[model samples]
Target: MSIVLSDQDKSTLRAAAYGAVSLMAAATGSPQKAATNAAIALRSATGLVGHVLAANAKDIELKGKTVAELADRVLPALTAAMKLLGEQAPAEAGNFHGTILLAIEAAQIHPDKANAIAAEMARKITAALDAGVAPAAAAAGPDRPELQKAIEEIVDSGFVGVSLRVHDERGEWVGSAGTAELGGAAKPPTNGHHRIGSNTKTFTATLVLQLVAEGRFGLDDPVVKHLPEFGLDERITVRMLLQHTSGVFNFTGEVYEDGTIAPGIPIPYGTTGQEWLDNRFKTYRPQELVELALAKPARFEPGTGWSYSNTNYVLARLLIEKVTGCSYAEEMQRLILGPLGLSGTVVPDASPELPEPHAHAYYRHGDTTVDVTRQNPSWTSTGGDMISTTQDLHTFISALLGGKLLPAPLLTEMCTPHPTGIPNMDYGLGVFVVTTDGGGTVISHNGAAVGHAALMYSTPDGRKTLTAALNCVDDANLTIGAAFQNAQQRLVNEVFGGGQADPA
Candidate 1:
């Protein structure tokens, strides 16, 4: 069965699944021991049910003064989860039922059924799971055809392929259009992984802020303290890096406001694209990327101006490694991916692989079109090298904005906007704070990497989100740049309450 659970529905499943274990733990009177054993069992679950239950538990909130009070909320949620899953995915409903039972069994302090109170709690849990639910009403949301039409319009605009996912009051809607490969008839996988380009900045920024939250470093501390080998400016603080106020030259290239372009590394564009294509598999260390940027004159004195510099995030990645004594990928997993159970997102350091079942991305150099899906992403490093699916993007943005990831004060700091000289949009830490034409606000970050690109946007509350992946024929000229911007505006208007204008 094809199932798309809304964020609310997912939240319900999390609460019900985790609460069931909490109830068993409470009954056992050895809450800590019982909870530990139950968690192991929950983590061991397999299949669709396993995926749902394993998401970041920070979103699961169970409020009650006593075990009885907790049961009142959890039992009903258990019934609700079953009803929703049964209507959408009957097989998954069975899996959910089985997983909870096993957890409760393992949670018992006396596994042989010697504890009367715990056994009684198990019976109550079983009864809730087995309770008959009313016939599910038709899902309340925009009909599928309308969403399908929206994406088809994007394909018509020139993209080779598009895969989109949106979560709103309509629950969840997903659709795809065009083709996975230029010459292939199959559509892009709705949940396929793709290079997330600069959206990796958001993840990198969050990691820095997380380290800050742990007191590892202060936002105002100079970058020199941790990464002294680079001899960075004393005025360049960690906050400046996260907010793009450091004025470091962009290693990708620089586009001055007067429409002048300065070259950086050879990339697929015009004739230079030929060189990039030939060297697509070559890897560059993060240090080398930073050195190249530093060799150029500072964009402006640190903290004196704002500029979008990929170099800033690469520096952030280096600092993360320095203070944590772990690689960027390791810290990412420990701090974010593992906690959130984001299995499809990858921080591919120097790796030239884009996992299986993904749409092919292509680039055109002169008259030759080549698949560039597996290029070494270390060229972009954390600035835009990570890979992820639309689903994981939704889970992440929703969790982060919903206050599950960062503490309140820090999240506020992350979202507060500074002028970026663009109309109606401003830069926040690693994200863009856009005030739509219709006067709505969204937190967003979009990225393009050669033939592949990804979009991530969400409301301030994170209750609504739009995430998408695109594959297209790209060249040095970025001929499709206009179409890419329009695609973003159209999807944002359709999914969020308003639309944004061109950055210019």
Candidate 2:
């Protein structure tokens, strides 16, 4: 999932980063204070990007100019500007271009200079990104145009960015499209981390099943037996919770059969946009969240019908915590992440941070868009707040299917689907049994939290897999839902030959 950069690439990126900082400062009329501030910001961005590229995507090149070498070679004024500005730059930040863009967007750069800066950026991209990937390249499997066109179509449909990685019999292939940050030319970092949303269910589900495999508890065990404090109906078994047949009220809100949504906890927010945004930083205990859902009327009798509920997994988190006597984050590391070597994933129990090298996500506010990249994710809790990259996702799902993470029977139980929640789609314990266009099944799950989302899928044997991350302009009205759905299908069909099967 990551590209290993050589020494030369590091120097290229560092020098390019410094020049980018100087360029923005120069545009602002070389004010002494502005120069110093830009320096601090620029170094932070560059350093972050440097470590990211080295760790994740080695294929990302600065494009066209080799970036800022010209600025460094000919411009003594660049050095003079920095000297005039004192050195106080942070060691690192999220991404190279985005850090600079954030600086320029907030600074007093002249319109002309800003355009020049934009032009410079417009030409900047990770190398080989703009051209067609030849089928014969043979590095990560044969380059499939069907796959390439799927992502291109997704970007054309208006999602801001996508990073996809696949593993098939031929080999592996990775590609990305759209922009890493809005108004910038670079593609999303192919291995950049982003929120994995409800796909966290699969991970949590896997953890619980692992516990079952360890004989810690039975799948059919009553929830009341483990954490009797919630007073959950005795009929609601552990299996029902993972399968989403528990009929519990969704804490974040839910949509019903009549096309009416009963709002719960102002969540995933069924209310005004700004109010949800305002509460993003607030933290709630898992019990608080579960109790809030419990206080809401049950959607249906437990195990009687099906509806997707975020509350199920929060309770699952508590279940894991209760049984293990440690935090879910700690158990996740010990059980799956460390064993599978998924370096790009994080449990992020209430932390709002996305590790370095991530696309900026945007939330639409009326006619304008607001950056929604960082917010306390306790609202997402165990259901949807986990962060990960395409590579780590690929590794996790592949290992899970390959029987590296659980006993064969449990993994089988994990993938077996029951009809529920949505039409034509069937729910497995934590994964989805999506019957594809080819009448073949692909084990899969996908999740979205506000402006960022992830897609994951694999064949029954795990020999083939597709894992992807997308950043986009999102809204309370689900502005991009239709197009986003279309994009997911296109990619799914191209990669997995999806037919009747759809991503969950």
Candidate 3:
């Protein structure tokens, strides 16, 4: 039975509906301002149905706009609408028909909206299609029932969102589960862009190794020999910095066994939302981050023990800058991203904006939360500041293992592990050596910051691989951290088999 609207309710709806259409038309005169106001009005409305109407109305008014222009107008509407739907719907809002319907309708009515929606849809559908068409795609393709089950398990395990991409026996498969945010019905973009955290280390390491292959520096050379101003111990070599055995104190503060905090840079997790938001665009020099760590006592004497330190990689960034006389980003573009044709990867520098067609990422502080989805990544600096897609990451790892990046001898050296005493896990230069129970070994390096994580894995020879990007609510206590790790391991096993080792 149709739910009847009260007379007053119908009148309000009519007035509001007409007002929405008029606002869209008027705002079109100052397309920018109209777009802004339309976004604000749409945000104030409730439910997927309202969002659908608002988006439709806006799209109709903004006819003839470019895809980028339409996105600028529609995305805010989509974000606000998704947030409302996620909040109002029951926790077990099964099937997500409302969101799908709204999206389809928006695409059908407005050419601009249709273009934007179709572009995103294509990324997902093409990945699905490629799985069947490519000969090698069948190895780790997303069609595997086991792979789908693993993705479902992650969503079931309490993660707010997850997206996975794998390459193995069945080819390449990409899957996503959970809402983009806490109360949204739309699934996180299965191939959406995300900050790839310390996985940036592997990129940084690869660039440095590429220079090594070019005869820019030797692995055993002391870091102090290149940048002596920091007073690094001569024992700290380039290899140690890459391998995290350099004993450099982590500049982002460190937690000891007794739970004491050693202070360093003002990381986002430790600051007020407004403060972090304000400083988001500020540029941080690698030397500044390194000196900050140097001011503290070393985590241990150089090479005494192993500990994860963002400072080590920041130092590597400085080394790249000093030696090449180019910005770390420029070097990355020239050395890694450009050569590999990784168009999806970005070194944001002091820029806070993501390219077009991405999901919104947020941070909850207290009663007042903030939208930090567009903040400049300079705050993380070189440590965890790169953005990339699962596809690009998959290509990168596959290329690296396939001998497209490093030479055979150096790649071998890069994968050599120094045991960390964690069962089945060891630290290589910038990667991890993970031993599967079935006796197969996968080389990988995984990392996460506040809202993102990256997983890059390869068989020894780089013939089979898996890479993924995950976005979620990252908290200090790591409440859901274990589940993320577990899900990653399960996906790796399902694709690469339990006992296959890297052939390198």
Candidate 4:
């Protein structure tokens, strides 16, 4: 049933809007004097949302006006601003709507009909006011078209969506491209969380080092020394596991240099891709995953060669548990996520959910595009099953390299790289040390899960960083490997080529 509002309801709604505007403006800086702040804010809001004002305004003459009159006059522009932001990022549109609706509840306008108009007006006013933000924030914002083009190129290369965040001396710039879901237009949230994949290895390795620093074990100690129940090889030292020198088989399956495959778990992107899709939500313990790999032959003798083995990380997970009598998730929070204030991160165990406001990941299951955003990541365990946002990744990597997480010597030791047979490419404990044509070495770790991926990179000094998340249609064949690699190189060159971050 439609309802109408009376004059008294309008007056109360106006009063509430005035109060909220004054309160919100103070949050930006002016706490002690809201009225003085409100006067300053109303002027700023009109200037910032001037395009909206210009579009919505009629023949009403322009002149200096009181705060109440300006608020009433700009209500239409506010609604338009919210609509624009909603259209720009659909994932956050619902939250914006909820915020606007909540603003009216404090008014306590009686009768459902009166409440409806109040809510609508409140939403419009709140949105328009929010668009005003602060002049300093707007000035500090990163809108470099060149970086924007880089992300656009990534999405244009057949990915569904890509959300990127770059923290550099140029300041923090975030951008996204493509649809939040297939067959839609809204961009992914730049701060949205996605599967961090093997980036979890970096976090797990950090935990191991932290334990070592606590005198729990030495990096050179044998794996079996702590995890004796697993019967790991005597030569497979803790360093081997962190450095991919353990020679253990990758439980997700491993590819030999000659291209033959040794199968382990039926995880995504493996030869058993269809089987993995069928059992995506099935849970497996870390030990169970490690056992599957143990049943297979080792890739090489301990410390002889390097291979990306998920099993090494699963063993690390159990090692963490066995050594500390705590789950990997709890320890990670205690040592890293919680300490760094990364509230968006989740150490999900046997969980198939991505936190809200995330781009949905898709996979090609024969002819249909399947939504694989939610799946029991226990299959990958500590090797690849963590979820985080670009912001959190940036915070974690910056902290780690800036000497906030580990000691100077340990970080130096952690960064020491061993050639992985790929020319100029080396693997560190859980990170990659790549010598770039830019005449600099970049420390990085990137990972991909079923239909999602994360990109994390930082300078050795941690002064600059790039962290990103993407959703796309993936399959066992790794259909987008070329595009993914190209995207990586393009971004690297743009970021670190001694001021050669060209848009082209």
Candidate 5:
């Protein structure tokens, strides 16, 4: 299926695509160099998209005295370009979209300081691209209005935007409520990408378990055997790390049950407001993050108690790298993402690249609110630094539970629960096992990273699931934490037949 674009269409596409780079350059105040790099990235595209973008830009007029004026023309043009490409050549629609994002990335200057500005621009550009097509799905007519109400209530409860996907007996329903950005009218893209926060633990744990199944290492092997350089406790085993029974201090601060706080690195919550914003782009190596936690006293002797810690996952990530002689991201691709065909998922590592068509996330510092969507996630590492779409999450969880990614026995062990001091909801190797109100079980894990959050849940058999992404206005005080919890409970109760307690 070849796409034959009329000359006018090509002109519009070229102008829109190149004008996006101009917008990025304007945001960073580096027009000349940014334009040069962006042009190279744009022309680097292959196939039909390459030929179209490689065409001379001399005839195109990117008219605007100001960035706003330019965006007025370029944004609509971007949408029109996507609409025509999607209708005429759907595959090229993706290619065209990727090329534009690459150019935008190449156009950045001093991204550490310009991140919020550049991210806002990128969000606008992505929104325009997404606007070219209809939403992936919506709630209408007589089907699952309660489901729709759940997400709308999430927004009404102070979330900026929400996109939800459900797969059950009635087939799949995808819907979104609220605006993509503050003070904007566009709804969040139903299938957009998001930072899944600690949900990365499920993926990391699944990878470790898969390696264990293959005899690369035993689950009960001492963690020091794989990586003696860390001088980890000999009692800490691979199983303990995955199960969060390692008692390692969480690198991203901790809150005791007594309401006391132990601060580690500055993240987007607690007393980290101004400090976190100042160091938002600072990159922390996985080892550095783990070492920071190691410097703190252990919360309990290895295997003595259960506590959620980011360092455990960081150690797991390092173990995977040590055993496989590959980076965590590489093994993840080979074992999980590639096999599952999860094209929209990524282990960002130290990269702050949140892909296109995502709703904006924000953080408030007293009187000021800033877009925190583009901060470097290296601080969290494999603990919570992955990006994925709701569709990919549903696929991953369902497939993993459906016996596609692991052996049946190993999967059973993975889902086997350990008491996490929370009643009715127990911790598995890397997931939460909940006793639903109907006496059935649900396997789940949900996580939040500052202003962005994700909810991932599924029935025991994986026959039903609810996955969602949320964007909100966050504060150091965590004013939105209660709403986040209620939103999770509301959705789980409505979708999974009730009785979900204290999601992780």
Candidate 6:
């Protein structure tokens, strides 16, 4: 009595299920609509089943039957198919329910076969609902163990919380570990919001380059021409700013070879926890951040050497504002966010709350580490004030690589490398050009501030992308820092054809 669905039947079932669920969800606006849509969906699914059964019966080929005869014969065959399938119990009733619903609504064939499929699908669906299991949950894909392990390792690596989303040949995988907030048991939402750190630099560079595409500015144009207040060396150009060759002093304090820390404005490092926590809500202007760095000596002469400087991007932010006569955030929205439909991403001005269903991020400071999870991000400004989910990050990177954002030639120039004195890696415009031993190149950027870090990576063609947000239990020993880098490499290699490095 058991029915064994052929591969074609299985494929049809999957397609039908998806169609049914989508139609039901979309057409359900009110109680009346829901009822009407549900009925329509069920009828459509039933008709599809009838069509499939009728087609199967005619394929027997031993007797050359006319269309009417085939149709007549199909009723009994469909009844048998349904009885046999019912005895076997549909392995994925949730999937079948959806497919059947759609077939019923759209079916233009035999009504009897449709009714049988609809009845069985309804029975199974009701049973599932009565058991308090969502139909969607029952049809969910299998869990990814490898991705789950990676998330757990990140949580163990001293982050207050961590969440990751990865996409590969296997499709999208998302997972999270650790509490959303300090001393809380709730796990972070894998797609929750977090500070994107220096990843903002990539966006800033993209905007600048977009304007460049429009002839508003030239890459080689001197930075001083755009923003005369920086007192920048004439050798520094817009290209240098994006490439981090401007040699601007890092405003968030610098560490020399001898480990001398020349402090800039007060940040979360080695400070009283409460002071930073209190000021977390304060807003910082891009000019203010740049001015603080300008107050200090240049890390090296502009265009002479390379050093990572938040001040450089802050200057770029100012340039964008000055040229567009709109806030950097607004420009970002108009050019990127709005166009890409990245609704979960934001350029938070002084906002502390992440968009709903977000993970909590925490900062650690003082001899006894304290949780500063809910501080204002204004201090980071254009340097690292953006908030985004993995989905948005993936969408942005994918679009950029897929040529939705920049022209091909400009994107090529943006990804071109400048020597950073680091082997195997070079700094591209606002991104890192990481070359793997496999002779493959990945464009990526990793950023950290206080407690949160964002990692973004994409292949040259942008067909593949990897994006993650990590919130660790940051400490003096840098326990989380080391582990985070390893995790990043592991994921990159796993998704992009590489291997893990020494964990030490």
Candidate 4 per-residue lDDT over residues 1-504, each given as its tens digit: 111223333233233334454333323323344333333222211111212212322333322255455555455443443444333322222222223333222232231234343445445555554453222223323446787788888999988888877767644566678878988877887667799998899999999999999999999999899888778889999899999998998887777879987777776675677888888899999888888888888988998888888888899899999999999999997998656656557899998988655898987877877899989989889988999878678778988999999988899989998878765568889998877785687788888887788888888998788888888899878897777777777787778763112110
Give per-model TM-scores: 0.76, 0.73, 0.70, 0.74, 0.75, 0.71
lDDT of the candidates, in the order given:
0.82, 0.70, 0.63, 0.70, 0.83, 0.63
For 95-183, candidate 1 gives per-residue lDDT tens digits of: 46645765676687565347889988988998898672222212312255666787899899999999988777655565678999988
lDDT of 3 by residue, 1-504 (tens): 121333333333323333333323332334344334333333322222333334433224333355455444443333333233233321101112112222222222232233443445434322322332223222224346676677777778766677776555533455667777667787776656778877888899999999899899999999999998888899999999988888888988887779898767666665443455567667776767788888888878878788888888889999999899999999998988766656557887767766543555655555554556677776567778888877568767877877889999999888888876577778888887878887777888777756666777878777677776566665434555677767676677777776322211
- Candidate 2, residue 449: lDDT: 82
* Count of clashes in candidate 6: 24
Model 2 TM-score?
Answer: 0.73
Error of 4 at 208 (Å): 0.6
Candidate 5 overall lDDT versus native: 0.83
- What is the number of backbone collisions in each predicted candidate, taken in the order shown? 4, 10, 23, 1, 0, 24
lDDT rank, highest first?
5, 1, 2, 4, 6, 3
**Per-residue lDDT of 293-386 in model 6, one digit per residue for the tens?**
8888888877888877777888888989888899988999888876665555678777766654555555545556545455677677767778
Evaluate model 1: give its lDDT.
0.82
lDDT-wise, the better of 3 and 4 is 4
lDDT tens digits, residues 1-504, model 2? Answer: 243344554454454444444444544555454555544444332123435333433432333353365444423322322222111111111123334443333233343244555444323322111221222123223245666667878888888988777767644556778999989998887667899998999999999999999888999999899999989999999999999999899988877779997776654334657787778778877899999899988998988887888899999999989988999999998898756545557888887887656898888867777888987788879988899877678767877898999998998898888986565578898888887767788888899888898988888888788888989998877878888788778777777776433444
Better of 3 and 6 by TM-score: 6
lDDT of 2: 0.70
TM-score winner, 1 or 2: 1
CA deviation > 4 Å runs, candidate 1: 1-142, 501-504
**What CA RMSD would you report for each candidate?**
10.5, 11.4, 14.0, 11.6, 8.9, 12.0
The alpha-carbon lDDT assigned to residue 451 of candidate 4 equals: 77
